[model samples]
Every structure is written in C-alpha cells, then in structure tokens.
Target chain A: MKTLKIIKIGGNIIDNEAALSSFLEVFATINSPKILIHGGGKLATQLANQLGLEVKMIDGRRITDKATLDLITMVYAGKINKNIVAELQSKNCNAIGFSGADGNTIISKKRPVKPIDFGFVGDVKKVNIETLQVLLEHKVTPVFCALTHDKKGQLLNTNADTIASELAIGFAKYYQTELYYCFEKNGVLRDVSDENSVIREITTQSYQNLIDDKVIVDGMLPKLNNCVHAIEKNVYKVCIGKPEMLYDDKANFTTITK
Target chain B: MKTLKIIKIGGNIIDNEAALSSFLEVFATINSPKILIHGGGKLATQLANQLGLEVKMIDGRRITDKATLDLITMVYAGKINKNIVAELQSKNCNAIGFSGADGNTIISKKRPVKPIDFGFVGDVKKVNIETLQVLLEHKVTPVFCALTHDKKGQLLNTNADTIASELAIGFAKYYQTELYYCFEKNGVLRDVSDENSVIREITTQSYQNLIDDKVIVDGMLPKLNNCVHAIEKNVYKVCIGKPEMLYDDKANFTTITK
Candidate 1:
C-alpha cells in the first residue's frame, strides 16, 4: 500500500502570513500523496466582531450559530482555502480547495439538541473515500476547510483536527496513513512551563499516565485523544507538533502509537 | 459526442431565495452533462457597504481592488458556491463547486494595464477541459463561481457570461454544447418599452440588423455579443432569457445561432 500523509494545521500557524507561506513551502515538498486540513484563523473572529456578531462559546469550543457558520465558511473555505491552494499551485503542486459540501465528499450530522445546542456544528458521519480517491489517483491534492454538509443542504462547522483524524482513518483502509496535527506548540511537554521538555513519544498506556498527572489538560486533551483514536483505528502513527515536524526528523513533536 | 449544457445565472436569480431555489430545481432535472456558472450576487456589494469599503465602478463595470477581490471570493466562492452545491446535493445532484484555482481547471490572463487598469480582473485565457471532462465522465456536475486565477497565486474577478462562453467554446470540441444565459429580462426585446416583444431567434444577419436598428444596447449588448461569440466558436446553440427557457419553449427567450 502506498503511504499517505494527512496534515492538519491549526489557527495559530495559519493566522500569520509569513508563517503560513513558509509552512506551505515545506508542505509542497512532501513526496507522498497528502491531504491538508486547515482551521479557521483569527480573521473570522475579527470579521465577526466587526459585523457585530458575538463569538458565542461554551467550554472554549465555539457555538456556531448560522451567522458564525457563514462567516467561517467564507473565511475558511473561501479566503483561506483558496489562497492556500493558489500558493501551493505556485509551487507546482496541483491543489484543489474544498468544503465537505463539494462532491458530497464528507456528510456530517448536526449535533442533536439534547445537550447544549451547538447551533450549526456537525460531527462528521461519513468520508466518501472513493470520491477523494479520484482526486488522489489523479495527483491532485485536496486542501480542506473545517466545514461539512448534512446532505440536507446545511453547511456545518466542524473541527479541523477531527476532520484530519477521520480522513486518516478512512484512507487507512487502502494506505499506510500518517496523521500530523500541526500547531504553534513544540510538542506535548513534560512540564507545562518547560518548553524544552518535549515528550518524544506516547503510547496508549502513557497517555493515561500523563492525563492523571494533570500535564495533559485543556485543548491538548481533545487533540491528543484524537491522535490516540486515529492510531487505534489503523492509522500507522500520529504526530502532534509545529508544522516543521513534517520535515525535520528531530523536530520537537510527540508521536502517538499503539 | 455527448450533449452538454452550460448555464450562467446572473444575480437576479441568486439574490432572491425563492427564485434561485426554483431555478436550481429546474437545473437539477437536466439529465445531460452540464456545468453551471454563477455571477456574484448583490451580497458582495452589500458586504462592502457593511464593511465601509468604497466600490469603484467605471461605466457600470466593477474595479476589483484587493479588498473587493477578497470580498467577492468570500461571497461567490465561499458562500454562494457552497450553498448552491449543498442545495443541489440535497436534490440528489452530485455537484462540486469550483473557483478556477481548484484543480487548475480554468486559467485566466490578468488584463494588461494599458488603457484601463482593472486591478485584479481577468479575461478567460484557457480552460483545462481534460480536468473538467474527468468530472463529467464521473457523473459529477460542476458549479463554477466567476473567479479565475492567474496561476501566479492571484484569484481574478471574471465576468460570469465570459466564463460560460469560454467554457462552452472549450468543451465544444468534445461535446455538442448548448449555452444558456439566464437573466431577469424575458429576452432581447424588439422594442425597448414592450416586455412582450422578445426576438425569438437571432442569426448572425438578424443580430447585426438588431444592433443597426438600436434595439441591442447597454449591458445586454455585451451579453448578446458573448452569445454570438459562443455560436461562432462551435457551441451548438446559445439561449438568453429567464432560466425557464431551459424547459419551456413557450417561455420568452432569444436563441442565437451562426
């Protein structure tokens, strides 16, 4: 089976133009077939503020009301996705931008109202690997925005990290898939204050130990959990770190495995 | 050769939800290999106004400055295109939305800054028919936004009518293409004041006569001219009028032929 790399970039890396351009330069050089999943940056929040739309949140996760959903759809799928595709194209990378709505590539279910209503948020229900395989087979790279559709005509806001993990799991059936979650951090640190204390690797056994020690808390918990979930679902390995981890073998990144 | 329909819908249909929905419903029923090209709706300008940005226009054509370009990319490619794709998907049409940058499907030349510096406006230069043909052969219908790229990482605002015509011309080599320009008015009116005076069929000779008699003027001139250009370029036929003309011959429309 051919090796496929799925890389997810968080808003911190995407928020800065020079950082994004530099990261894309490295991203364009990866020899294996790859998929890029990008998060919504600060610009969407800034634009929402300018438009007088409140950035509703509960538990640090956003509540994507219809207005916020539209804003992110524009910012993520529109401006950010297309710009990334264009930049990749300039590097001779054949890239196409997509939301899940395109080609019915990813159909998601709107979170039920039983719990706190998350408005238009969706949890991905399906990834049409066959549809994506067509693009990969043609050597066309897909740049995805964190948005999915319900197949009933509503675009829902989704988590970019979850999207990457789900995609890796789906493609794992036909390929040795490696998932990379790229953000501003060096890696999962041993001590919260010590940036240099990067944990090189974490197995399922050690992940629970870190969680018990309170070192793995907050946003890192969900992200690390996603990594473990992907690995369990047949992904060869999952890495969490800065975007440079893709190229530099010694880069500070935490590798998660069974 | 297979029959293909290339339809361009102006802002009139898109701005009104009911109308756009009705038009799309009719569009989804067309069984031929088809492509839909859409013009930017009034939402972009409305957004510009909300953002307090000046919309510069010369002789009714927009000057796409950097800000304007970003605005349209958001509204057209992000909001409008994805929504349309989602809607079509709900109707069981496997539609994929595209900006020219996607899959490098359409490449345009930035209009030279000779007499008029149109900022980021582009003229259709090339269409990657093979890339598009792949979608057609796979039963995936494409929905295009009126934005093209210069391959140098710039998305250029393009005229939707021109995009439709260029696509029709390019696809004519492989398919018997019919182009439709769906707009607000009934068709080319024989009398400026009479709504019922639609010119049923226009040939090269009759089109010249219509212009000689002062019937064809203003924006319709350029639109009708595109229709004639598509005819000369081997598109089997070109129709201009309400979208209903696609399914209803009794509906008012002007059919152009060489």
Candidate 2:
C-alpha cells in the first residue's frame, strides 16, 4: 500500500499567522500524498460576538444553532480554509479546500436530539474515498475545514478530531495511513503545565493507566481516545505533537500504538 | 467537441432565499457539463452594516481593502457558494464549490493601482482548464464564487462577469461552450422600465447599433460587451437573461453572436 499522511491541526496553530505560515512550510515539504485538516480558530467566536449572536455551549462543545452554523461556515470553510490553500500554493503545494458540501465529499447526519440537541452538529456518515483518492493521485493536497453536510441542503458543525479519525479510517483500506494531531503542545505531557515532561509513547494499557491515575483528563482525554481509536482501525501510525514533527526526524512526540 | 454550459448569476436571485431556491431547482435539472458562477449579493453589505465595517464604493465597484475582502470571502465563497452546492446536491446534482485558490483553478494578478486603486481586486490571468476538466469529467458541477487568488497567498476580489467569460473562453479549447449571464431582468430591454421589451437577438453589429441608438446603456452595456467578447472568443452561444432561461429551451432572451 502507498503511504499517505493525514495531518490535523487545531486552533493553536491557526490562530497565530506566523505559526501557521511556519507550519505550512513544514507541511509543504512532506514527501507526497498528504491531507491537511484544520479546525476553526478563535475567529468564529470573535465574529459571533461582533454579530451579537449568543454562543451556547454545553460542556466544551458548542451548541451549533442555525446562526452559529452560518457563522462557522463563513469563518472556517471560507476565510481560514482559503487562506491556508493560498498560503500552501505560495509554497508550491497544490492545495484544494473543501467543505463537506463540496463534491458531497463528506455526508453526515445531524446529531439526534434525544439528550442534548447540538443544533446543526453532525456525526460523520461517510467520506467519499474515491473523490479524495483521485485528488491525491493527481498530487492535490486537500485542506478541510471543520464542517460537514447532510445531503439534504444543510451544512453541519462537526468536530475536526472526528473528521480526521474518520478520514484516516476511510483511507486505510487503500493506503498505509499515518494520522497526526498537531496542536500547540510538544506532546502528551505527564504534567500538563510542564512541556518538558512529554510522554514519548502511549499504548492502550498505558492510556488506561494514565486515565486511572487522573494524569489524562478533560479535553485531552477525548483527543487521546480518538488517537487510540484510529490506531486500532489500522491507521499505520498515530502521533500527537506540535507541527514541527512533520519534518523532524528525531521529533519527540507521543506516539500511540495498539 | 463536447458541449458545456457556463452560467453566471447576479445578486438579485442570491439576495432572496425563495428566488435562489427556485433558481437552483431550475439549475439542477440542466443536463451534464454545466458550471455556475455566483456573485456575493447584498448579504455582504448587510453583514458589513451589522459589523460596522464601512463599505467603500468607487463608481459602483467596491474598493476591496483587506476587511472587505475578508467579508466577501465569508459571504460569497463560504455561505452562498456552499448553500448553492448543498441545494444542488439535494436536487441530485453533484456540485463542487471553488475559490480561485482551490486547486489553483483560477490564478489572477491584483488589479494595477494606476487606474483608480481598486484595492484587492484581481484581473483573471489564467484558468486551470485541466483541473476543471477533471472535475467535470467526474460529473461534478463546479460552482465558483467571484474570488480569485494571486499564487503568492492573496485572495483577490474578482468580478463574476469576467470570471464567467474567462471560463467560457478557457473551456472553448476543449468544448463547444455556451455562456449564460443570469440576472433579474427578462433580457436586455428596449426600455429599462418594461420587462416585456426583450430583444430576441443581438449580433455584434446590432449590439453596436443598440449602443449608438442609446437603447443599451449603463450597466447593461458592459454585460453585453462581456457577452460579445465571449461570443467572439468562439464560445458557441452567449445569452443574458433571468435564471429561468437555463431550463427554458424556448426562453425568449437576448442572444449574442458575432
């Protein structure tokens, strides 16, 4: 199988222009057949505040009402995605930007309203592997925003972590896929505040032990869980680290294994 | 040569929800090998007002400074383009949205400051016909927002009329192309007030006569000029009228020819 890397970058890099530029420089040098997925940075909330839309949040996840969804569509899919594509193009990376709606590449169902109705939020249904594969074969790098769509004319707010995991799993059937979750941190840390205390490797047993010891909790918990899930689903490699790891041969980051 | 239809829609249909839905419903049924190019519409201006961003206009053209350019990116490429794509998908049309930056499909140079300093606007330099052909071959209808990118990381505000013309000219090399400019009016009118006074045919000679006679003046002149330009560039057909003409084989509209 051909090797393909699916890299996901969160808001930490996106919110800082210099960091994003530096990150893309590293991403551009990756050998070939790589995809970049980005999360909407703080701009959405800032724009929402400017537009006087109340952002309802239930436990860290945003309650994506119609107005909020529209705001995110404009911010994430429009502004950030295009900017990234243009920047990558400057670096000679042929980047193609996508919302789930584009080419119907990602179809998702709206989250069921039984417990908590996260307005226009969608859980991933499927990724159009053929379309993505064709683009990759043509040497086109896809830059995806954190948005999906129901096939019936609705754009849904989706988690970027989930999107990354889903895409890695989707591509696993055809490629030896490596999934990287790039954020601000160096890696999963033994101490959250001390960046130097990075845990170099994490296995499923180690992850369970970390959780039992309360070393990994909150937002990081779900993200770590996603990494484990991707690895189990046959994504060749899974790593969590800063963007520099893309180019660094001796990069110290948390690597997840079965 | 294979035949392809390229359609451009102005803001009137886009500004109204029901009208846009109606337009998409009609656009959806058009046979394969068609593209849709849409303008930003009044939503950008309305949102600008709400955000207190001053929309600077010079002789009816927006002076796209950085803020205004960002606003339009969110509105034109994000909201409107995605909405149209999703709606077309609902109607079973596999629509893909594009910014010039995406796939480097359309590359432009920032408009020269000598003329009036139309800030971030761009003039079309080249259209990547290969990328577009690939998408079209895959049965994807590309819906373009009126924005292009300079290869060095800048998105420029481009005119939809020019973008439509450029695409028609580009596609003419591989396909017998028909370009349609869809706006609010029935067609080019003998009198601006009367919608029923639609001119049935307009050849280059007759179009010049209409101008000398002062029947076609103001905004309609440049549009007709674009039509004439497209027709002369060997686009098989060029028509200007309301959106309904896409599906109306017997639609009475002004047809442009050499």
Candidate 3:
C-alpha cells in the first residue's frame, strides 16, 4: 500500500527560521507522500503590536476582529507559508505552500457568535482532497497555512491544529493516509512538566484520565482533540511526538488507534 | 472626490531585507487611502531552482506546471505578502497582506491551453470589491500578491500587472480611486537606454507609436497594457513613474487619459 502522511508544525516551530530549516532537512528525507500544515500566532501577535491593534483572546482562541483577522491572514497565509516552501526548496525538497483559501482547498463557515462577533474566524466545513492529491502525485509537497474561506467568500482565520486534523481525515478517507502531529514536546507526558516521561500509546479511555487530572492544558488540548478526530475518521495512525523522535524506534510518543 | 490610490511595487524591490526596509520607509509617509499589490518573481524563481524544478516560460508568461505553480503560490502568497505587511506595521502603517485566493477577493478562469498545458495559470475574470471595501473602511491597507482561484477550486498563478490593473479598475468603478504604477524606472522613457529622458505624458496615439517602434518590451509591455486598460475603464488618473516621483509637482512620468 502507498504511504501518505499529514505532518503538522505549530507556531513555536514555524516562528524560528533556524528551527524551520532543520525541520525541512528531516522532512525532505521522508520517502512517503506528505502534506504540511503550519501555524503563525507569533508573527500575528508581533504585527498586531506594531499596528497598535489589540490582540484579544477568548479562552486561548484569538478573537479575530477585523484588524486581528487581517493581521493573521497576512502572517499565516503570506509569510510563514512561503518561508516554509522556500526552506523546503533550499533543501531540494519540491514543496508548494498554500492555504485553505487556495482553489477553495478548504471551505468553511463563519462561527456565528451570539453576543460578540468573531469577524472572520471559521470552523472547517469541507476539504478539497482531489486538488491536494494531484500535487502530491507530481511529488510536490503541499505546505498549507491555517486560513479558510467562508461560503460567502470571506477569508477566516482557523486553528492550525484543527485544519491539519480536517486535512488528515480528508486525506485518510480519500487516500488512506496516516496523520502525524510533530511539535516541540515529546508527545503526551505522564507528568506535565517532564519531557522525558512520554506516554508510549494512548486510547480513548486513557486520554480522558490525562484530561481529568488537568495535565493537558493550553495548546495540548487542541492537539489531543485533533488526534481523536483523525482516529475516529479511520486514519491509519495518528502519531504525536517530538520532531526528531518521529523516526526513532524507541522514541517516547503516543500512537492513537481506533 | 476622496483621493484613493493603488500602488504596485515590482518584485525586484523586495529582494532583500535592506531593500524592503528602504521601500517601507517611503511607503509609510503616504497619507492617501491606498492599497498595495506586489510581485515575487525573483524569490519564486530562486526557490524553484533550489528544488531542481524546471521553470518554463511561453510568450513571456510563466507556464505554471505543477512544481512551478506550487513554488509561485507559496512564495508570492506567503512570504512576500507577509513580509510587506510586517514591514508596514513596523513603520506604524496598518497594512493587511492577502492574495486573490483570499475570500475569493479576485476570482479567475483557468487559461485553457490545448496544445501545451499551463497547469495553474489563471486569467482573472472578476473582483470582489465589497470584501476589499469592508477592510478599507476599517482603516486597513490591503496588500495583495499575484495569485487567484479558478471556479473548479484550483489555485492559479495570475500576472501581478493584471491583478493591479483589474483592482484599479474595480476600485475606480466602485470607489473612484486613483491608480499609480510605480517601478524602478522614472517613467515610460522615449529612449529605452536613457532613463532621464522620461516621456512626461502619452496620449493613446503616442502609446501606439511606441508599441509600433518596439520600444516597449519585456516587463514594461504588460504594465503599459494595464495602464491603457485602467484609463479606458475611467480611472481618475493613471500615473506611471518612479516611487520617489509619485507626489512630485513636476514628476517625470507618463499619465494615461481616456
């Protein structure tokens, strides 16, 4: 069977140029077909500061008002997206950077708020797998940023983790691909602060225990959610681990299976 | 009439950090309501070369085969677009970078080639002025790069000049905005080699003469065509000049009038 992978890198990984270059080198060596999705929170926050635009957050989710939405759109879809593609090319990796907005690759609907408006934040409603598969067939790596378009043709900021999950599910259904979530941490740790104590594997039952103990907070919550979503959608495997530990046989990580 | 302006910067201008900063300083001082569109040919070509991908050109238009199209989309839509927005913000300019793909701000039709397929090149067919206007109303400067989407949901590479022209026409019709085409050259010169011998103004008759004499060639041809199109579309004024001469009383440039 042909191997397909969805690799996700977050804001911490993408914000550092040197780290991005190092990640690209490792990514180029992967023999299987892959798609990359990235986040751009650092860049967006910096831009917001410069523009005197307030960065509002509601429960860790960015309140994407008009100004914040524009800022994120520019940073995620424009800067971080292209920088990754350029880095991949520097390593002789054939990579193409894109976003949810491209060719309607990811269509979504605006999350209508009851009291406060989200301006342009979208919940992923659909994914166009055929377009992505065509590029992958030509050995081109599809690098995507988390920016989607609503049904009314408005650009909306979406979470990178969510976007990657949706894409993994879509690819899993379309081409039976595996999903890998790579980040700075060493998967889900038994002790929240201990990086070396990586959990070897996780099931639906154990996942709830970790959450009930309040160990998974902030960024890790969404990542776990994505993993569950991918597994439920019948992906071959959903691996969560440190970037370098991906290839290690004994690397501490969590593998989610249905 | 509200003096709205659209300024287009060549891809060459933002080749490096120093050049980008220099341009941003000048860009920050402009008081008029404006929109920015930029090109990223050099960066795209460099990335393509590193990946050992063949860059094809036909009739002076890029043949965006799978590899080339992906590289162009990533570089133009991502890196160049965000960098400009960041630079502008650093200078206290509220700028928002985007692409034709965003919110379907610019919709296009794939350039149908029968003999030799240009996989992802698009000819723009429509512009979503309402989306842009909404951003503008919120005091956000919309910075666009040259990339669009086809109806079939494919990301297509469109010409930067074409994007600027279409945007100028749209803004003019929708908001009565002025259009300025700024480049390295002082203006449309009478002698191609002599930069100082700028043609102050050119009527349709003189423009035809220049075209007949083979004076306009390469990159300038499309720009000239765009200028003529904007003028014909009833834009308030279409000026072709150096960035420095944009607001000069005796600016050495060419103005196209209907």
Give the Cα lDDT of each candidate. Answer: 0.90, 0.90, 0.74
lDDT of 2 by residue, B1-258 (tens): 888999998999899999999888888888869999999889999999999999898888779999999999999989988889889988999988899998898999998998699999999999897878888888889999999999999999999999999999999989999999999898999988998899989999999899999999988877888899888889999998987777777777888888
Interface RMSD of each: 0.9, 0.8, 13.4
Individual DockQ of the candidates?
0.80, 0.84, 0.08
The number of clashing residue pairs in model 1 is 0
lDDT of 1 by residue, A133-158 (tens): 88888888889999999999999998
What TM-score does each of the candidates earn?
Answer: 0.97, 0.98, 0.57
* B43 Cα displacement, candidate 1 (Å): 0.4
Docking class of 3: incorrect
Better of 2 and 3 by lDDT: 2
Residue A38 in model 1: lDDT = 95
User: What TM-score does chain A of each model score against the native chain A?
Assistant: 0.97, 0.97, 0.93
The number of clashing residue pairs in each candidate reads: 0, 0, 1
After superposing candidate 2 on the true structure, give the runs of residues whose Cα lies further than 4 Å from its correct spot. Answer: none
Ranking by lDDT: 2, 1, 3
The alpha-carbon root-mean-square deviation between model 1 and the true structure, to one decimal in Å, is 1.3
lDDT of 3 by residue, A160-179 (tens): 88898899888776676778
Instruction: Kindly list the per-residue Cα lDDT of model 1 for residues B82-184, writing each as its tens digit.
Output: 9999999998899988888888888899999878788999998888877678888888999999999988988999999999999999999899999999988
Better of 1 and 3 by lDDT: 1
Candidate 1 residue A68 C-alpha distance from true site, Å: 1.0
